[model samples]
Target: MASNWLLLRCRCGQSFGARQGTKPSCSRCGESSQITTTAVFTDPNTLTEAVANANLPSEISQQIENKLNEKKRKKLKSRDIANAGTIQRILKQSTDERGVLTLQSLRVCLDIEGVTEPSAEQIIGMAELQGVVHRAGEDEWKWLA
Candidate 1:
């Protein structure tokens, strides 16, 4: 069947299922399959020229600047960086050959004095810092080191 929408594959190698609009998850694994598309120019000069000629509404320009500044401010948070580094270290030390670091293993490695599954965002943040672990086949992780 022809679809105006593109078929998107997640980092985990899962394909999105059919839905009225966008499928929320993979039917086999229930993993999220959000798709993002953008146009990219290979030549820096081309991008610079396009931006220079682009018309911008005053309000939209101000809003865009505000968002960029907000992101910059957030990057200054000490606690977030410290935690990301800590998790990166633990993952490097503890992950096994199968690349399946269970939630239990992670909790012990991090020594979370309290109880709860690690927040998905926190797990993602750690992976972001380490740059070696990414969503792999099915529910497994793909570790580089």
Candidate 2:
């Protein structure tokens, strides 16, 4: 027996399968729409291909792409910021300078440790986000705690 499933693409880029004749809601953004029989498929492969070629309205597609990119950026930012070694190095290097941290100082510390991982900008960005540092000037950073 051929199994029938409805393929759905939400404005937020979330895709899922649902039963026919049901109004499915996007888990990501809470948008819902009634399923049409034309969107139902018996073959999963054909459903995948159809979803890939589906001509979404340009505005909706753009919104979906932007949401996806934002999610990716946030994930990377969190990963970079959560590096314990980097945070400890920055804190240690800033101690002698009366808690005044600079991008150059952080870079030098990373270099001395033979860790050329995250760039100076990324480290500084993470520090700012953590509320441990703030811009003192164009090229200087003040350590908050």
Q: Largest TM-score belongs to which candidate?
A: 2
Which pairs in model 2 have colliding backbones? none
Top model by lDDT, which number? 2
Each candidate structure's count of clashing pairs: 0, 0
Candidate 2 wrong stretches, greater than 4 Å: 1-82, 94-96
TM-score of each predicted structure versus truth: 0.30, 0.39
Q: What is candidate 2's lDDT per residue for 1-145, written digit by digit as tens? A: 6667677877666665665655677645777864233477888777766665663455477889999988876666645443677667655775444667777777777666545457778777877898877888887888777
For residues 2-48, what per-residue lDDT tens digits would candidate 1 score against the true structure? Answer: 33332334444443323225555543356674432222444445544
